[model samples]
Target: PPNGAFRGFGAPQTIFAVERHMDRLAEAIGMEPIELRKKNLLGVGSTMPTGQVLTGSVGVEECVRWALEDSDYEAKRRTLGLANKPVGGRKVRGIGASVFLHGAGFTGSGEDRLKGAVELDLLKDGHVRVRSSSTDIGQGTETVFRQIAAEGAGVPFENVSFAIPSTAHVPDSGPTVASRTVMIVGSIVGHAAKELGERVCKEQEAGGGSFAEASNRLIEREGPVVAHRRYGHPAGVKFDDATYTGTAYPAYAWACDVAEVEVDLDTFEVDLLGFWSAVDVGRAIHPVLCRGQLDGGALQSIGWALCEEVQWKDGRIVNPRMTTYIVPTALDAPPFHTHLVEEAYEHGPGGAKGIGELPMDGGAPALAAAIEHATGIVFDRIPMTPERL
Candidate 1:
C-alpha cells in the first residue's frame, strides 16, 4: 500500500502536481502552455537554486524541439480544441505536453562523498567480469551492465560475465538508486575496461599473441589482471550540504512528454490514446533498452494520472488488493512513440547519462495540460476519475 519505490522516484507525483499549476498559470495569463514552457525552460547557462551552474551538453532545448515537431503539438492542440465542441459520442479529445529535467546522480556533494568504484577481472578464457554493488531489480540492469562491460572491454557480448552484487567480493559502487547505475557505475566500468583493454592490447603486441593468450599470460605473471577505478566528479564540482546549496547533480536528463487523451463527456472517464516522449539521455548505451525504459516509465505515469489512486484513511490503506488498486495493463496502455536526443555529458563514459526515471518525470504534467482543453477544468489533483470529475 505504501510506495517504496517506483519509476521516476518521486517525480511522477511531483511533476503531475507542478504541471497542473503551470496549466492554471498559462490559462489565467492567456498564454499558450507550450509557449510558456519554452520561455521558461532552463538552458545552457541556467543556475540552480543551490547556485550551481549547468555546464556542457545540456539538452533540454533539444528535447523540447524534437518533441514539439514530432508530436505536431501545436497543430494537434488547435485541431483538438476545435473538436472539443459537442461530439456525437459525447467524447472529446485533447493533447497534453510536459517537459522535465531529472538529475542523473546524487544531489550535489553526494557523489564526492560517495567515492564509487568498480573492479573488473579479465579471465584466461577471454571473458570480462564486472564487479560492483549495482544489482538488477528487474529493470534490465543485468542486460545493460553486460552491454557496457563488453563494449568497454572490447570483447564479444557472449564473453562477458555479470557478477552478482556482493559486498564481500565487490566494491561498493554506491546504491543502485538515484538513476546512477548507468551514468555512475557504467562509467566506472568503462574506465576500468579502457585501462584493462589498453594493457591487454599492449601485452598482445609485446607477445605477438591473441587477446585471450595475452590475457592468460598477464594473469599468470601479474597474478590476476584486474582494473579498478574510483569515482571522480568533474573538475570544480562542489556542494554545501549545510546550506543545501551546490550542484544538484553532476548531469541532467532532459525529456519531453506528449500525451493524447479522449474524455467521455457523459461518463467523465478518460481514455489514453497515445503517448510520445523525446529525451536526451546523454547517449543511449543500448537504444532499444532505453526505449523500453521510456515506454514503461510513461505508461506508469499515465496510470498514476488516470486511475491508480490509493484510498487511505488516517494513513491506513483501505484498498490494497489488485482488484481495488488500479495499474496499467497492456490493454490499458496507449500507443507509444519514443525519441532520443544525444547531448553528451562530458564526464560520462561513451557519452551516457542515467535515464532510468526520466520518462516518468514528465508524463503526468503533459497529460494534465491536454485535459484542460477537453474538460475546461484545471486538474489540481491526479487520477482524474469520473467520481472526481
Candidate 2:
C-alpha cells in the first residue's frame, strides 16, 4: 500500500467502523441507537479491549453528558418520532452520536522514556525565550507553550518568545503525535521556566534584593539567562505490545459528541444539522484554542461518518482529487457547541493534560446513533452513503 504520513493516523477509520456497528446494534435490539451507546459508555475503571485500565483522569462520562444536554438529544429523539413523516415529499431526518478516547503523550511507557528538554532564556530586558523541539503543526502548540512558560516564569505573555525547532538549537522532544505535544513538551517547558524563576529568586534573596533586581542581576552576570529541564516517565512502568493487554496510556482524554442530522429519504442523503461535543482537557490554558480543537475534531468526525471516503481502485486511491474525495463543506457542517471540562491530573504541568486527539474520538459514534434514532434504519458502513442507506 502506498501510504503517506497523516495526522489522525488510524482514529478516523476506527471511529467509522464503531459508529456503523452501533447503528446495526440499534436495529437488532429495536431500541434507539443513542440509548444503546449510553448504556455501554466507558468510564474511569472501564477496561478497553486492549485491557488497559482507564485509571487516570477519565472523563468519557462527562463528555457524554455535555453532548446529550447541549444537543437536547432526548427531546429531539422524542420529536423525531413525530417528524418521521416524509418532508418536502422527499426528505427524511435522523440523528446519531459517538464517543471516543485518545491517549495523551506516548501510549504506555513511551512517556516514561521520553527525554525532552526545554530551555528558558532570560534576556537583559526582563523578557523570556522558550526553546523546544516540538513542532507547531497549525495546532497552536507554540502559542500554548508560550502561555505555559509565561505562567511558570511569572512573566507577561508578551515578554516570551519561542525559538524555532532545529537540531542545532533544541533538544529532541519526540515527535508531535498521539497528542503528546501539550502533555509532554509543555511540561518540560513549564519545568524549565519554573526552575529559571527559582534560580533568579534565590539570587535576589542571597543579594538582599527583590525578584526584579535578581532577574536584572542574573542577566548582567550570565549575559543571557538560561535554564534547562528534562522530562521523563517514572521507573518500573511497562507494557507488553504482543498481548495488547498492558497499560495502554499513561493518561486518557475523553470526549462525547452529539450529532443531529436530517436525512432525505428519497435521496438517502444525510445532512448534518448540528453538532455538540464536550472534552476533558485537564486544564484549558487557552479556552479559545481548546474549544477550537473540539469544534474542529467534531467536524472531522462528522465527515468520516456522513461524507469523507477514500475511494479505492485496484489497491490505489481512485478518488484523489478534492472534487471526487468529498469532505464536509460549509453547507455540510452544522453549528457546533463545545464545552471544556477540566479535571486536573497530578503529574501534568500545572495540572494540565492533553486535548489534541480527544475531540475526534467521540463524534462518529454519536452521529451514527443519532441517525438511527431519526430514520429507524441502521447504517452499518463508513461514509453512510446514499446507496448503502
Per-prediction TM-score, please? 0.94, 0.89
lDDT of 2 by residue, 1-389 (tens): 55763446677667667766766777698987667778898767888776766665777678788878888877777767326564554665555567776777776667656676777788755578888888987788889999999888888889889888887987777877778788777887888888887777788678967666788888788776788888776443457766766776667677777777777767877777788777888888888887877777677767776778787888888988889878876666688888887877666776678777766666766666666666766555667777877
Give the distance in Å from residue 61's predicted Cα in candidate 2 to where it truly belongs.
Answer: 2.3
* Model 2 worst lDDT window (10 residues): 81-90
The list of candidate 1 runs beyond 4 A from truth reads 1-3, 87-89
Candidate 1 lands at a TM-score of 0.94
lDDT of 1 by residue, 130-163 (tens): 8999998767777887887888879888888888
**Candidate 1 lDDT:** 0.83
**Can you list the residue pairs that collide in candidate 1?**
96-370
For model 1, the run of ten residues with the poorest summed lDDT: 81-90
